[model samples]
Each structure stands twice: as C-alpha cells, then as structure tokens.
Target: MSEGGSVKRSRCFPAALLAVTALGAFNAAAQEPPLIRFGRGFAAEEQVWLMSARPELTPNQGKKYQLKQILFQANPERFQAFLAGELDGGTAPGLAVIFARAQGVDMKIVASVCLEAAGREWFSTTYMVKDDGPVRSAKDLKGGTVGVVGIKTATDLWARAGLLNASVVPDKDAKIFPMGFPGMGDAVRTGKINAGTFVEPFYSAEMARGGLRKLFTAVEAVGYDHELLDIWFGEKFLKAHPDTVRAFLADYVAVTKYYLANTAQAKRDLHKAGFVRTPLEIYLKNADWKRDPAARVDVASLDKLSKFMLEKLQWLEKPVDVRQMVDESYLPRQ
Candidate 1:
C-alpha cells in the first residue's frame, strides 16, 4: 500500500509543477504593458511628439503604455488608419468624429487638442485670398473655386459655413476643390484656385511669399470660437486597456499643460519632433490653437456644431450624440 501511494504522489507532483510553470508564463505575458499606436496631423495639432522630448512628463509612458505617434496631413487620413485598425487613437476634427460615429467607427472624443477661440488669437486656421487679387470678401468668390485640405473636413466645413454666412452659397457661388495646404497658396497665387485654407508654419510661409490676404478665420463660420480638432481613441482600445489609457491621458495632460505654459519653448522643439520642416523663428512668431490645459472639451459647442452638420451643411444624414461620444473619465484628475 505504501509503494502504490508513493508512486501516485510522485506522478501528481510533476503535473502540479508543470501547471505552475504554465501559469507563470501566462502571467508574465499579461504583465507586458499595452502598446498604444497614436497619430497626429500638423505641427500644432495634438503635439504628442512633445512627450518624447520630456520623458519625465510621462512616467508611465514606456512602463504602462507604449506610444507610437504618426504624422498625418489631415484628419481624414487619420480616420482611414483608424478604419484599417492601424491606429489606436489620433487627432480628429469634430466633423470627422461625428462622421466616424455615424458610420459605426466606434471612436470617442478623449480630450481637446486644439480649438479656435473667438477674436484674434488666431494661431488658428486662416482662409487666404490672392494678395493682389480683386477678391476681398466671401462674396468675391462667386463663380470661383475654393481650395480646402479635404472635402468634408474642418477646412471645408468652415469655408462652406463662412461663405454661406456671407450670403454666398458654396458649390454654387464658389466651387470647392480638394488640395493640400502647402499647394493652396501657390494655387491661389497662380489663379488655379481662388482661395486656400492655411494653418500654422504654412500660413506664415504664405504670408511671407507676398500675395495672400486673409478672407476670414474659423470663428466666422462657427459663430464663435470652437474646437478645431480633438484627440480621439478607438472604443475597442479604450475597453481592452483602460488603466493604460488613463496613464497615457495623464501624461497627455501634463505635456499639454507644459506646452501651453511654455509656448515658445514648445514651438522651438517642434522641428525636433518631426513636426515642422519650416524655420523655428516663424513658428515662434505664431501661436497654435488654444485648448484647455485640463483637456476639457466644450460639449455645448460640439453639440451645436453637430447640429449644424446635420441641418446647415447637410454633411450628416442623421444626428450624432456628441455627449455620448465624449469620454472624459479617462482623463487624469486635474
């Protein structure tokens, strides 16, 4: 009887040890921090690259969540990456955010990245006309073509709304053309297009080139200063790794606060982050968009903008729940 029991115990001991080893391997794999692949547009938007310059701001960045930032030209391309599941999160305009949700993209507005406030703090988007050209107002664009970074984008929406507000009908009084920001100024100067949408670094360049005049800014169309673009995260990613995202948001808030407080220094480092190809002096002279250091978004403004998308612009077939699309819980406590 002793020999039989001893043999049975030896056999079960090996099985128990093997199970313990397998469980340890599984736990180790689970302990690996989540990798967050994020994207951004221009030098001013999101500015996630700044985090790399100041690692101390993101203590949990490499420890809890890995960040990969992609530079995109516009929000549409960023959303394309989101659609292909290539990006976990990135900067997206309110129009694109609504369009994505309406089309079942499953994204949430995590925080405010950049916003155009009422008044001349522009550091925002600028709509420019030929400097020496006869076109001065939205009314002057009648029967002319207007260039936008992309159709159905913030630039397009603003241009349309701005023209309409001036009592000029878009696509009727002025035709909308899709083009890149860099080419817009040249196109306007060469007369291929009537006007172009301008953003930082590029806007300064155009102004220096000596032939573009400001027609209007984003505030003219939105009725007041509003969010131009915001940080968005895939709903799936947020669910799969909530704690990691929280850490990332905390880092984001820190860096943004740092950037807002030290605008000049932040712009100086813009080129270091692969954000600016232009000279640092120009970027220093211009400020980027304004955002809450706490990363709070204007829900009322977004809700109103979504309504405009549905009614005025006919950009949406149905209404989107802006409030429901915003997830502020992931933001670190201020």
Candidate 2:
C-alpha cells in the first residue's frame, strides 16, 4: 500500500522541512548507474503502448536499461525503489506522485504519458449483490459493504469524497472492502462484496459479467476533461540523461500520435496487452486516450493537484511549492 492514509476533506497541514531522509546507500552506489527498467501499473492504453516498444528502450537495445513489467499491484514498492535510486525511473499514477513526494522521493513528471480522449468521466463503479439484494446509487449503500482497489487510492479517495458530498459516508453508510486490482471485479460478481471501484478494463469487465451497475464515475465528479494521470522520472535520472530523456519524449509523442492515428493497430496491440477487450472498434472508440503538444508539465494544474492533496492532508506534511517539484526546462515550450 502507499505510504499515506485517507483524511477528511478539511484536513490541513503546517508544513515540515522533510519528514523523509535520503537513503545513504543509494547515493554511494550512484557512481555505477543501473539499467533503466520501466514500472507498470494497471492496464491502461499507456502501458499497452509502452510495452510494445520495450526492447529498443532497454537492455535489449544495448542501452544500460532493462524494461520489466510489474503489475499495478506492485507499483508502490517499485516506486519506492525508483525513489531510493535502486532503479532508474518509471511510470506511476498522478496520485502516486503525491504520495511519493510525501515520502521525500526524488522524482519529477517527465511528460504526459496518456491523456483522456474520451475525457474525464464518472466511470461506473461496478456494484453487485445477491439476486434478491436491493441497493442503487451512492445513497443506496448506507450500512452496506463496498469493495475497492485500495484505501487511500485515487479511486477510493474520490469515491469517498463524492459519496460524502452526496451525504453518504462509507463507514457510516457502508463498509469498504479493499482488494488488489485484479481480484476486485470477480469478488464483486461472486457476491463477496457489494460494489468495486476500478479503472479501465476491469470496469468494462465487471459490466460484461452482468448484474452490475454503474453507481458513479470519477469523471462526472471531477469534470470530464480532468488530467487524471501522468508519467514521471527521478530528478537524478533526468539530470544524468537529458538527451536520452528528450529523445524518449519525442518518441513518446510520436508513438502516441501513431497510436491515435492508427488506433486500429493500437487497439490490436493493446488488446494483446490485456488492457482491452474484443471488437477493437469499441475499445478504440471508448478509450479516453488523448495527446497534446502542451502535454508537458502544466504548472498550474500540478499546483492545484498538489495543493489539493496537501490540504486534504493526504500526506504526512504539506506539499512543497509546485515549482520546486516540476522543472520544465527539458520540454520544448508550447
């Protein structure tokens, strides 16, 4: 699980110098830079696209890096490894960035890895129950059981916030059953839990299982066009390989453009990655993937997200100034 815990929406912070200290062993071993290994979490289109190009980007490419696929279930520990400088750097959720910073991890957003072509939306949190059970809407679950990917996860956080805003508290109105991302959907279907909060393929999967309904979607609550995710790297890695990082970014933009332009092929590859389902057209059309020239760090957006996480006391301390965390000198200005 991530380092931080959930807090009330009104939580505040007085700020601190740094609650986490650097790992000394990492600094000493910095002389022999390790190979580049990509970290993956969840089966979003971004991971599918990235996985296809792994060889050229890693040890197979004769580069001092090796790309390994880690399940989203292991992202937290993998992210901690990147922060400790044991691994080069990799992709993570936007919320992971917030939690990593709270742990004093030295990392930065490299580029917009994925954007929502379909836009932010209240994706259905699949809810299931006995054939005779009766519950619907965020309001219907009072004193019921709700399944989720994890506590303090972005999905869980927003679900709670949205329910409260709707006047339904999870603990008071319902109990949250946390499970790994992979198992949550099936668990819901088997009647082991009531509803499950998930993203992408799993959300679609739950619906396919039948008898499940969309309670609420994250996008509906946060606005449809919200930038809910990103990819990032360690600051040290960026400083060590500026030219390489830039080349990777250029390729990333090109690759994503390719993915969008030839979405047919992209879907084929994505489906092979287990990130999508059959009928390529539906996945292509339904996927919220998007890209932009301005996909570089949006300081304003980052600031808002950072402050929101801090003010919500999602971390051990307040977030540092957004400027301190994001350095856009590498990205060609839009």
Candidate 3:
C-alpha cells in the first residue's frame, strides 16, 4: 500500500508542476504591454519632453506601456515615415501636418507641442545674421538670400511673413536656401546665406557664440497666437490602439509638466540625450519650453496656418479642413 501511494504522489507532482508552469506563462503574457513607435524630428522642446516621458512609460511604470522613439533630421522626413507606416505617430510642424492631411494622409492632430502666443516669447525661431553684417532689419533682407530648414515649414512661413511685413516679397525680394538648422548660423556667418533661421538649442548655441544678431522671431512675424508644432498620430493607430493612445497622452502631459516644473533638470537631460551641446547657462538663457499643460489644439491657429499655406504660399492645392484634422478625444480629461 505504501509503495502504491508513493507512485501515485510522484504522478500527481508532475501534473501539478505542468499546471503551475502553464499559469506562469499565461501571467507573463498578460503582463506584457503593447509597444508604441513614435517619431520625432530634430532636438526641440517637444523632444525634450518625449525623452523625459520615456523612463516613466515602462511596462511596470506610469502607463505600463513600452515606447520607442525614432528620430528624423527634419519634420518632413518624420511625417513621410509616418505616412509610410514606419511610425505609429510623429511630431511635425503644424503646417506640415495640415498639408499632409490635405494630401490624403490619414492622421489626426492630437495635441499641441509648441505655440507662439502674444507675450509668450519663450519658444521661437529667430532669423539671424552676422552681428556686424549690413543687414540691419527684416527690410534689409530684400534681394538677399535667407536660409531655411525646409520649404513651407513653420520656419519658411515665419521667414516669409517677416520679410513680407518689411515690404520684401519672399520669392522676389529674398531667396530661401534650404539647409539644416545647425548649419544655419555658420552659413550666415560665412555669407553662405544672407540670413538663416535657427530654432531653440541651435538658437541658444548661436547666441552664445556671440557673433550673430536676431533680425526677427517667428512670434514677432506671426503675431497672433498659434501652434508652431503639433503632435499627430496615425489614424489607423488611433483606431487600433485607442487605449494605448490615451495612455500616451496622459504620460505626455505628465512629462510636460515635469519639464515645466524642473526646467534646469530638463536642460541637463537634453544635453545628456545628445539634443544639445551648449552649456546649461546658454541653453537656459536662449531656450524656452513654454507649452500649455492641457495640450489643447488651437483651431484658430490651425485655420490661420491653413489659409497662409493655401492662399499666401500657394504650397497647398486646396485648404484642409482644420476642424477634421484635429481629434481632441485622446487628450487626458481635465
């Protein structure tokens, strides 16, 4: 009887171990979270927030979701990657997003990354020239060449508006030479271009170098309040992963708050992330991380950009429905 009982217990032990192993596998599968691929362009305030948000989005952390950020050299490249299904979402200049939507890219403007409002001079793109150069003002750019990061982007639009305000026709009075933001200052300094546009970190670095002067800023050019950059998610991603999208926005808002509250720390983080090489003091002095905590999309600003793109620049064949392009449903509840 004892021998029979021992054999019976041995058989039951194997069965129990199998059940436990299967349960463990099931639990592990359940604990695994969905992965999100997000694309960002050049180092900017938004990218800083994104980098800060990354650590908090781990599988066992805030959102319990995994985030992967893909970097692109320019906004157009970022948007193109999103359209090609290489990215789940991306950051782009608001104008680029609008133009892409007009061209039938199924994407939605989920949040505003950066905005230029009246009295908010914190974040802006500056038109810079040699401090000792003959170009004293925007009007001086007439018949001169201006370097821009891209055509029809926020920088291009702002540069054109500044020149136009000074009675200089963008195409006629000034020619736009496309170049990288990092090279813009050197171009202006060496006369490769008459003036160049520099944003944020690059702007700060150039200012610290002490040989350039700002001719105008984007905020000064487009005076009324507007979004400079917007956060967009592919429509298919939104539809397929609504929960993940909501989680991402929540984490993004939290991270943005962290950025605003601890700006000094954020700047250090940006340097560590290889976004900027400038000293902290220089970055702090010239970089502005102003953003609305609610991450609300400004419809009025969107309308303004669309009108400028379609009517003024003639960059778009037709106006995009700004109202349709924005979907605020994903924003974390107030």
lDDT, each prediction = 0.83, 0.58, 0.79
Candidate 2 ranges with C-alpha deviation above 4 Å: 1-35, 45-48, 54-72, 115-133, 270-286, 297-301, 312-316
Sort every candidate by lDDT, greatest first. 1, 3, 2
Candidate 3, 1-334: lDDT as tens digits: 9999999999999999999999999998887767777787665654334454447432333345667777787877787777677898878778888888888989999988878765545666778899999999988888899998888778889888888889899888789888888798889989989999987778777777789998887878877778877888889889988888887787777777777777777677776766667766777676574588788888888899899878877888877899999999998899
Report how far off residue 243 is in candidate 1 (Å): 1.0
Q: Give the 10-residue window scoring lowest on summed lDDT in candidate 1.
A: 40-49
Would you estimate the TM-scores of all the predictions?
Answer: 0.89, 0.73, 0.88
lDDT at 55 for candidate 2? 33
- As for TM-score, the candidate ahead, 1 or 3, is 1
Model 3 spans with C-alpha error above 4 angstroms: 1-23, 46-54, 57-64, 118-121, 273-275
Order the candidate numbers by TM-score, best to worst: 1, 3, 2
Model 1, clash count?
1
Residue pairs in steric clash, candidate 3? Answer: 143-173
lDDT of 1 by residue, 63-83 (tens): 898888887866767888888
By TM-score, how accurate is candidate 2? Answer: 0.73
Of the two candidates 1 and 2, the one with more favorable lDDT, higher being better, is 1
